[model samples]
Target: MAACIVEPILSSGGVIDPPAGYFAALKRKCEERGMLLIVDEAQTGLCRTGSWYAFERDGIVPDILTLSKTLGAGLPLAAVITTAEIEQAAHDRGYLFFTTHVSDPLVAAVGVTVLDVLQRDGLDTRAAQAGSALRAGLLELQERHECVGDVRGRGLMQGIELVTDRATKQGADRLGSAVTARCFELGLHMNVVQLPGMGGIFRIAPPLTASDEEIRTGLDILDTAIAECVSAAV
Candidate 1:
């Protein structure tokens, strides 16, 4: 009741990045109301935003943070970070989520190893550089595709919005599905999040280890997918 939670970058919801100081203002308002600020980095954490945490760019720290998605390095691992004050309060109140293997030692060890690799190999910087190439390529795609309503995301995570009408910025759900299928057929598997009638949002999150060539190849496939889809529609 006294907490506000949000995804740093809207992923499945739309991959929308809020305006600058969005989170900082949100945290400020939450503090004013004596509420906790919780950031769900399920999609934008661990160098996805060209930073260790997306919130870093906003210059705000959440009282609680939730992480998942790529946290386990292809393993099913999630982590929650919170201020000691809130954590201690929960402990004092004996509040806990029921779980048996919630923090299995093996999985925890794996998480540690994953963190080590991420830090040791400098995958964060890798994501930044790789993301730059991918993002630039996506922007180029938008120039050629009338259906590309918007291009967004940061670091290794990027999204392209498809719209049937650029003036109204309407979503092109049907065309988006077609492009996805076409891309798959062309040997580049991808996903386009369909939010009912709103349209489809293509999420492009290449692995950090991906080479520059691979990123360019993916963008080329995506560009081809859009071209083919547009031609078919016409």
Candidate 2:
């Protein structure tokens, strides 16, 4: 049996370019060891990463892919895309799994609507443009705040990594949590994620319908929150 390889994002800090030759090296390893490469695109799929899928940006394709979150347009749906061979393998095994109420007509309708909006409104192109602006804004913020260790990611799925000491790159989880709470209090909804055994990262993923002004406003609030946290800590 070939081993199953999973690459859960190159970095939790955000969608980076997966390090030069990272995908190629992984593909080579998989081919050599007879392994299957699986990509979990839960957060970076559906134009979130500037491209339809983040893996596409890297010029690498996975044996199997899993998608959810934005697929149902906030409704509840998930799907798996794989090769015909994989589907045939499942059939050969005579394995059948089904959920009684898995197919909700309402949710299916929403999925269709989501796809229409993505195509007609050009959300993917918007994501690419807005993402570039957001990333540039974040890089400027990092320059202003010494506590910011790294600002990385693609399209709308971006993150700001906070560190107490840039030299050591130690995670400032508490500060990140403080910023998140303050943003919420200020009426901006955002998320702060703590990667087990890694540094703290603040995720900035607004709805695809968010306006350019709204994106600027959210980042402004974040900048203020970071400044406030750094000031209070000192």
Candidate 3:
């Protein structure tokens, strides 16, 4: 029997650090059970979380690392990084896979340009700093708006959780959807998430190239939408 474990750092509409002893425990368990640990950094990789890979922040390396999302910078690309041992194991079984249109030169060029821009413009550092500022501002907004229950995330990836009851922390799905629609109407694209076992959380992940002024403008529009929704609900 083979097993795989997928652990992501998402909680309370925020990206909480993984459990204090999660990595150590996972290493021990995986070694004992002979299971593979796969880290999926599709959404959290490519300096989106202030690090080349989010797992780097946890100080643990996975047997298999999957990446996509921003890697191609709007082009279709995905990658799986693994150790030589794993590669040998797969090759020993004579498993060689090839795909059609694996790497279009045009897309590859775009990826190269994206990497250049990210390094030249210091987007990783900018994402960290700008994300911190955005989180702080959202926290202040939460204090001002009863509808805002929590603000959480890191780097360019953040979420604003809307709640109808502060005591119970119940999600206000309609309110969140309304706010997203309002922001879109106000010319700012935003996401309203609907995940199982989670409440209404607004997903805010702007392009890494977005300027500080663009972030502020988007947030201002969001503030207006949130306020308007709260007022209309009363």
Q: Give all TM-scores, in the order shown.
A: 0.96, 0.90, 0.89
User: Over the stretch 1-234, how does candidate 2's per-residue lDDT look in tens digits?
Assistant: 464555445445443446656776787788898888888787778888777777775678889998888888776787778999988998999978789657778887887787788889888899999998898989999999998899877788788888988999898888888888888888787677656734368777878777889989988998898889889988
Ten residues in a row with the worst lDDT in model 2? 7-16
Model 3 poorest ten-residue lDDT run: 7-16
What lDDT does each candidate get?
A: 0.87, 0.79, 0.78
Per-residue alpha-carbon lDDT of model 1 for 1-234, expressed as tens digits? 689999989888877889889999999899899999999998899877788899998899999999987788877889999989899999999997957779888888888887788899888898988888898998898888888989999898898899988999888888988988988998888867766774568888888788999988898999988998899899
Q: Please name the candidate that would achieve the greatest lDDT relative to the true structure.
A: 1
lDDT against true structure, model 2 = 0.79
- Badly placed stretches (over 4 Å) of model 2 are 1-17, 195-199
lDDT leaderboard ranking: 1, 2, 3
Candidates 2 and 3: which is better by TM-score?
A: 2
Ranking by TM-score: 1, 2, 3
Error of 3 at 38 (Å): 0.8
Candidates 1 and 2, the one with greater TM-score: 1
* Model 1 alpha-carbon drift over 4 Å, by segment: none
- Give each model's clash number: 1, 0, 0
